[model samples]
Target: MDRNALLVGGAVGVVVVAAVTAVLVPGVLADPTDEGPIRPGPVDVADVSIAAGPATGETVTLGIETRIDHRGNPTQNVSVLVRAIDAESGLLATTQRVDVGNISRDGETTAATNLTVPREGGYDIEVALYREAERVDQAKRSVSGVSAIKPPYLQSTTSFTDTEALPPVSYSIEDAGEDRTTLDLTATLTNTGDEPAEDLSVTFVLRQAESNIVASRTTVDAGTISAGRTDSVDATATVPSGYNYYIDAVLMRDGVVIDTARGAANLNPTRTISVNQTTEDVELRVEDFEDDDDRTPEDYESERTRTESSAPGFGVVVALVALLATALVARRWRQ
Candidate 1:
């Protein structure tokens, strides 16, 4: 072979060998800046904690804290996904995701998220740790009695002072006459919370012990009661003489009753009444008279009788009134 031909043949052979090597061993001569296969670091869910947050309306917020343990290598683009599922139905209630960026050290890292769920039943909280789009570890926790959480506006800081030594409701006779008697009532309240109680009122209702008839009712503005302090509200009520009465003091805020207390006034010399004594089991007696203001006891009785006789199905009306009164009394007695 000629020298030029031998040289060209040798160069072609070298090129062929290089092409074969490049096809057989892929990426051996690839770009140095190119990325390799992604091998996710070892991550495990170390701990999961759930804390209840303030409730609003029918929903309550749950704070989920997830602790991740990174043992092998550093991780990047880590995230935590929190889900709240109803324990009874196994249905998803809510979900949230939080990004914690990169975990470079070989220690523990934390990720947190908040999920809002209905305040009705128990829930199972699930936490999942992810590296980018791949899930690495998961954990679960359970919480119950979510309905007990109260909203901020529904929570009261002030309540009526209830103790044996310090009675919440008290009364004294202001004047006595043959037909009627005037009494002064005082309701003592205490703030057992951290914030002040504002825009409050106390309603005093006088009910005859024998018939459970409301003789008089009055409301007094209590204004603001400071935190960790005790305050009093005074009211006046006049009723017919020679009758024992039970004074019902209802603590109110924004027209809603929060607490209640009871006291007795033994105006009748013949019969003595105690606050704890039970009265007759009769339907709630709501006065039917449109205007009982400045009306005498005899006039009230006459009007009540006349109205009951004239109105048909008075028993149903009385039953509805009883239900309403029972609900009101229940709310008042609630702690």
Candidate 2:
């Protein structure tokens, strides 16, 4: 009940009230409708697919498709980065960037790009989604056996007919003599493509069955053949008689061999042989030794002896002549 004490207590109470009001008033008066800073929506790589494109000698193009899913608020300046890394070497083979622009809706958007790489090994394809130059999500896919893809130039439209029912190579004996035989070789080809096959040639090689020696070989042009059509080319070969031969047919285009087939020619009348059959040991034919003048064996031996005797030394010749004269005198004394 002192006046100064009561006044000091009142002042302390007022200061405490003011401090509580300062702390609580702003939080109570804050607007409930206010929303905080606008953040970008979530963008994710939904799916990824890859397809093979045109192929050249050692390189090929791959088409990459990336699907992005957008949720929440709209996104701006979206893009997809595709990379091809060699699986074995862990080195980057190729890369490409595709712009997807703005993605406003909450759906999927596709981004496509092409990546060219060597057609030798497998690769790991990586797709990343970027928003305003910032990466949001990424995905990966793998492909193998790239070397199985064939180039355009090496893809042949025509091939030899090889089947159990039909053979590609066949031969006919045109003429057969005592020492030689002539064959007419035919090679059948099938064009399986949509376009005509041109600039083709076939080579016929006649190899002896027993010796594997090339007896005769000939090349002939194969005319243009329509698509889905089978045609034959002909060649002639003259081989030695009394032997079996294998007729090999080689199909070529622009000097490159595309296909090959084999047939057989049985020229021997006494012994029959085939290309796939094993060869039997045969007796070799030999002739008797004779002189160029058609002399017999006895005549040759007599001539050889006479030439040897004529080359004897002078002492040997004088001894022979004296012996003959002594023999003649003894014969006369006996008479």
Best by TM-score: 1
Estimate, for each residue in 1-335, the C-alpha lDDT of model 1 and write its tens digit.
Answer: 79999999999999999899989998768787878775657888999988889798799998888989986667789988888899999999988889988887888888877888999999999888898899888988999999877777667878888888878999998999877789999999999878888999999999888787788899999988888999999999988777788999998888777778999998877678789885434333344312456678999799799998868656778879889999999999994
Q: What is the Å distance of residue 213 in model 2 from its true position?
A: 6.8
Q: What is the lDDT of candidate 2?
A: 0.84
Predictions in order: lDDT: 0.85, 0.84
Model 2 Cα shift for residue 160 (angstroms): 2.2
TM-score of each: 0.58, 0.57
State the lDDT of candidate 2 residue by residue for 105-175, as single tens digits. 99898899999999998999998889997888999999998886767776787988987566788888899
Model 1: what TM-score? 0.58
TM-score for candidate 2: 0.57
Tell how far residue 253 is off in model 2, in angstroms: 3.8
Candidate 1 local distance difference test against the native: 0.85
